[model samples]
Target: MRKDLHEANRLSWNAATRAHNSHKGDQAQFFRNGGSTLFPEELALLGEVHGLKALHLQCNAGQDTLSIARLGADITGVDISDVAIDFATQLAADAGIPARFERADVFDYLAHAAESSVDLVFSSYGTLCWLSDLNAWAQGIARVLKPGGRFVFIEFHPYAMVFDQDWTMCYDYFNTAPLAESGVSDYVAESGDGLAVGEYQAGEQDFVNPHASHEFTWGVGQVTTALSQAGLCVARLDEYPYANGWKGFDGMQDSGGRRMVPPTGMPRIPLMYSIVAQR
Candidate 1:
């Protein structure tokens, strides 16, 4: 298991390293450019976090980490990508935000963190899919939380993964097969950069080899179950019909900076969910 995880981490790290390096210095810019604008609705659900001790798992390049710091949380961020961590550390230093960034697998970091050391465990979009084992992931979350500490997350709806292109749901909800998606740019790129249109780097193309990318079709039931199994009692679970980030769905419109299915209508399935669980 350790060997498998190590290999998986390597692949994910290598792929993410390039993206992290390219945008390392632009975290604040990204935020100011309407990054967290869409997120505030869901993020606001976390309530008052001023002065809280927060841990962000899979914190890529630390944009959200710094954003949370701006909210007054003493923050620590962990990611498998060394490049991401290095950039995050430098950004923190340059911005004068007192954030600690660490390079470590989430599981390893949680397993070894001093027990009950965090006031909150936070993760967001695109973070959980890389993890292969939810039970282990849950256990790690449980181990790190102090009594009454909270775990909050906002993730892409598993149902959104069913479609390869707009207007079709081609995949099974229950399938656990590792879907190898290649030849696409990193999801963060803007149009017309010239690398490959949607490709990651402008003027440069590279393949991202994700060692293990499995989407768990976790409905509300599964999400709550996993949190309960992890010993965190569910405090609140809220779902939104729209997403704060691009979800590759057709007919979805950007409203208040968030992507939403138009009122004229698409099926009202959730596009994102925020869960707050307490230890």
Candidate 2:
């Protein structure tokens, strides 16, 4: 793993957690009020998860972890950010929901997991871009799963990620290069309000309020190939023309409170995708 890149991205997400958990416009309140963060697509794909042993990777703030637990699954949430994990732990306790949270790099945690011990390994939206290596990720998912265990993952489509927030083609669809940005704003802020909170340097230059994010793009083929090479059989692949929420987009009409798809006369695109793979 690229430790440098991981550390850089971790700092940004750690900072993001603060804003996300505190902002009134964010889902923290909903989660605290016993709302499920699990989207409809993932819930449908993960039908009947009751009484399963589940592992939620990159489970920021433990909202989804608690959601799954509410569905009768024994869940353990893992995240790289210590601050985030701390918050998740407290959130779970405050909500009187039984959950376990660990702070560690996902790769390291999976490396130490008991072989064939987990019944299901899950992750969701905006989870894939932070990692520099997808093969290792798939291998980790395979490593922790029991025979016939399932790996259910949902993520923003790589093709959709190629566009900027305005849906304009601004980035390379097939680019493998890592992207670095500074002075990042909180993505979940109802408006452009919250800002990054630390000092950072991108060389000899130093800046204040510097939140740094480093992300890598992986293609659809890359994702499927990695899962296949990791010994997991792809049981189902579903593509959706909508995202769970508006991603700072314009001209998108809300289908319901939970979904936003392209309006009429607009060319459709795959905004998100879900994969169900089994060991």
Candidate 3:
């Protein structure tokens, strides 16, 4: 892993964390009222985790993590951003949910994580790009998972990643370079999906973080192959034409819930995907 680059991203996330929350109001109250941030796709794949030891990686703000806790699972969420972890911890307390939040880089946290300590590992939504080393990630996951435990991964597909926010082709599908984004605008409420949740009405704000973020675009093949080499058996891979919340182009319609889809007649490509791999 590129520690330097990863450090830079941590700073960026710290800054972005505040910006991400700035658009929202009363997050603690939302959790207290039994609100959730999880999409239906994860719910179906999650099955039953009641009383199972679980881990949520890169859990920002812990809204979804707390939701999982509602399912009666003992879960701890880990993230690299201090601000995010702090917010998550406080939210857990405010919501009266029993959970643990740790601030650590995923790789280092995984390195020191006890082998065979967890029954399930869950990670989702815009997580992989910030990770610099997938092999180490896979090995760490393989090491931590107990016998027969599976890792549930949900993410935006790399095929859809080639297009920018405007649906224009701006990146190479096979690109292996680190993307450095500086002075980026906030995405929480900009996608129009955030406001669609019908929870507390967010306040209007223009937010931007100047910190440079170092990210990578590891494709589907690279990820599955890494897990295979790390002794994890890939049990399932599912692709969806709809995306969760973040709409990348105009004319995107709501697919009956928080999911959004491309305009009516465009060629359908995978906007998101999920994988289930067992140790």
- The sequence of per-residue lDDT tens digits that candidate 2 reaches over residues 84-121 is 89988987877778889999888888989988988999
User: What lDDT tens digits, residue by residue, belong to model 3 across residues 135-212?
Assistant: 999999999999999899999999998887768899898878899888335677677544332353454466667688
Q: Kindly indicate the candidate among 1 and 3 with the higher lDDT.
A: 3
Q: What is the lDDT of residue 259 in candidate 2?
A: 69
lDDT to native, each model: 0.68, 0.78, 0.86
lDDT of 1: 0.68
TM-score of each: 0.82, 0.89, 0.95
Best by lDDT: 3
**Per the 3 Å backbone cut-off, how many clashing residue pairs does candidate 2 have?**
0
Which residue pairs come into collision in candidate 3?
A: none
On residues 1-279, what C-alpha lDDT tens digit does candidate 1 reach at each position? 243644555566666556534523345454444343226764676677898998999997776788788788998999887777887787777666778899988888888999999899999876666676677888899888899999998887777767665657798877655444442235443222211212233432453545443333445566688889989999888888876656355555666544555345566777777888999
Order of quality (lDDT): 3, 2, 1
